[model samples]
Target: MSFDDFYHAHFRGLVVQLRAYTGDVAQAQDLVQEAFCRVFARWDQVSRYDDPLAWTRRVAWNLAHNRWRRLRTARAWLLRQREAHVAGPGPDRVALEAALAVLPARQRRAVILHYLADLSIAEIAAQEQVAEGTVKSWLHRARAALAAALRDTTEEAQDA
Candidate 1:
């Protein structure tokens, strides 16, 4: 049979079979189309075979298997990326967070903006609509309070 005749006769059957194997009509269609493209490239040799349909079917199945393997590997890599291999928050972090929570709102904001956000005193003062001196004062007080709180927590932990 002509290549066109062979394709028209078997395309639907191939897609149906691939869909049954993959459980995805779109993927099955893609696999079948790709398989046809490969056969079209070597139609002369393929047509001589007693069972060209078997060769086409095998190619499509291999395509589906390869896609599944690649997807499985990618899924495993993504899962690894999501997993947190590093340790959880230690005692020092917990103590620091607790200490920060107890401070006044202004002090907390100033400390976070200055240290965590890497904002300069002038930038923080401009953002907070306060004088630079006022920003410095907040940071100084916050530092002292945080130091005292962390020290107390450490002492308590040591005592316990």
Candidate 2:
């Protein structure tokens, strides 16, 4: 079967399978698309396989598994950071809140969405109706501003 025919026939089923595996439709769709790209790149040899669709599914599953692993690693690192911060003298909550309040609305929103809501950059971009790069820029500026404000607050407290 031609690649186009195979893709049309199997795309939906692959997405469904990946969704079941990943438990997130967006991630499943991404994995399936990535698998398709890989297959398309090597279609000459891939088509010779007895079960090209099976090959595609295997690649998609592997991609999903790798994504899961990376997410787990990230979560663990975040947890470690949280623990380390908790063990130390953290910034004053009142000062942190004040710093956040002083930020521009867009910067505050971007920070809250990414850190508090644990949203991905792509998710934040979609929700904010802005490009991912815009979201990133907002986050960068917000972090810098917050850090400077917090540092000033710390120095004031030390002087007092």
Best by TM-score: 2
The CA lDDT at 64 in model 1 is 97
What lDDT tens digits, residue by residue, belong to model 1 across residues 1-160? 9899999999999999999999999999999999999999999999999999999999999999999999999999998888567788999999999999999999999999999999999999999999999999999999999999999998999999
Tens-digit lDDT track for model 2 on 41-142? 999999999999999999999999999999999999988777444454455877888999999999999999999999999999999999999999999999
Residue 143 alpha-carbon offset, candidate 2, angstroms: 28
Off by over 4 Å in 1: 84-160
Tell me the lDDT of model 2 at 143: 100
Query: Against the true structure, what is each candidate's TM-score?
Result: 0.53, 0.54
Error of 1 at 60 (Å): 0.4
Q: What's the lDDT for all of these models?
A: 0.97, 0.93
Q: Model 2 — which ten-residue stretch has the worst lDDT?
A: 82-91
Candidate 2: misplaced stretches above 4 Å? Answer: 84-160
